[model samples]
Target chain A: MKVAITSTGNNLESKLDLRFGRCGYFIIYDTETKGMEFIPNPNKDATEGAGPASVQLVASKGAKKVVSGEFGFKVKSIFDSLQIQLIVLKDNEKKISDIIELLNHENLN
Target chain B: MFTIFVLNICSLFMSPRPSRLRKISNPPVISGFRPYGNKNIKGKVEAVFLHFEEYEALRLCDYEMLNHHQASVLMNVSRPTLTRIYARARQKIAEALVKGSQISIEGGKIYFDSEWFLCSSCGCYFNNPEKQVEIKECPLCKSTSFSVYAENNNNEEEEEEEEEEE
Candidate 1:
């Protein structure tokens, strides 16, 4: 299974981005292969419909679960329809590395 | 006055639009009920399709012990509409009981309200996007200390007051 986490930077040490649609980067982490790929958000500066666009980007990566600080109202229904699990972490100080570790722990359990 | 009267007459001839979709705070746990042990000879047992909105109306009015006006506000519909829904729900239930028919709860012009949760460990608010799965721990820190966030009734009251002022 693969999980996507919104991040403030392209590196694992970057903090978790608080906003989902306008996040700086999206980290796609594969559980089985333990591989990570960072995709810069193209919709970061978009004035409208950023949430749905970001959802499309993440969906294209085949992410089963998404971790973010918050999700927009428009994206919630779309995600629900897609049957993609959403995990909200409120801690803005949380790093990408810590989130990946938590995902790893969850997979092990 | 003559133009206004003509406009009113024309409006009366037009068909009324459908009611707005009711907002359901929570989906029912079970799909519906079934009648059993019927000795009467029957070719087929008729099934009553109870809409989700009607089920919600029944729940709010009967199970929750709320008045029609209060339930209407909660459901985001007018009081008359809520009463109509409640009446329909009761009638369907009664029909199902008397006729030994199955009651299936599905299909309605309703939207499910998302529930918000507050994580004490991380001090963040989040909502459960998926309704099927139960949330056990905080998604960020994996902390179990959390609480279900309740809608603030005071906010609605304040909004009403502001509208009154306007």
Candidate 2:
């Protein structure tokens, strides 16, 4: 399964972005193949409807789960309908690499 | 004057529309029920559709044993509306029992309430967006020791007060 984690920077060393919609980058990590891709958030500077647009970007990548610090009010129902699981990690200091490690542990279980 | 009189007559004949959607704190664990051992019945029994709101009403009132006013407050609906839903739930249950029809619980003008959990190891709060799957561990740290987070109600009340002040 592919997991999408919002990040503050392009590299895995950066902390997890608290805001899902305006996150600087999205890290797509595939568990089976262990491939990672970083896509710059196109809606990072969007004034309106950034949440749903970001959702579309992640959905298009076929990520089954989304890890972010927070999701907007409008994005929950959309994700619920799409059957994409949302994982809200409230720790602002958690890095992308730590989250990826957790995901790997989850896959092993 | 004549057009106004006709409009008043039309309004009187029209049915009252339903109120806003009710908030359901918990979704039903099972989808529905099935009837059996009815030799007198033929093939393909008719099924009664029960709304999720009705199931919640029944649960809050009958199972949880809360009063109408309290249940309505939890559901975010009026007492009378809750009583009406409860009544419908009973009536549907009775109809299904008598006719041996399957009861299928699905579809309603309702919004689900997400529950938050606190990870003791990570000291982080996260909400379970998917209700169908059981959360076994913390999403971040994979910790087994966690508790259900319940501070959101106070936060909501505070936000409401802030809105009122603004």
Provide all candidates' interface root-mean-square deviations.
3.4, 2.7
Residue runs of model 2 more than 4 Å from their true location after superposition: B1-65, B68-113, B151-166
lDDT per residue for candidate 2 within A56-100, as digits (tens), equals 999999998888988888998888788787778878989899888
In angstroms, give how far residue A108 of model 1 lies from its true place: 4.5
Per-candidate DockQ versus the true complex? 0.22, 0.32
Total backbone collisions for each predicted model? 0, 0
In candidate 2, how many Å is residue A32 off? 2.7
TM-score of each: 0.53, 0.57
**lDDT by residue for model 2 (B1-166), tens:** 9999998998999877767778788778798999878899988878999999999999999999999999999999999999999999999999999999999998888866646777787776766665545678987667898866666775998899999999
Give the winner by DockQ: 2
Give lDDT tens digits, candidate 1, residues B40-76. Answer: 8468887999999999999999999999999999999
lDDT tens digits, residue span A1-109, model 1:
8888999999989999989999999999998899999999999999999999999999999997788988988998898788777777768888899888876775555
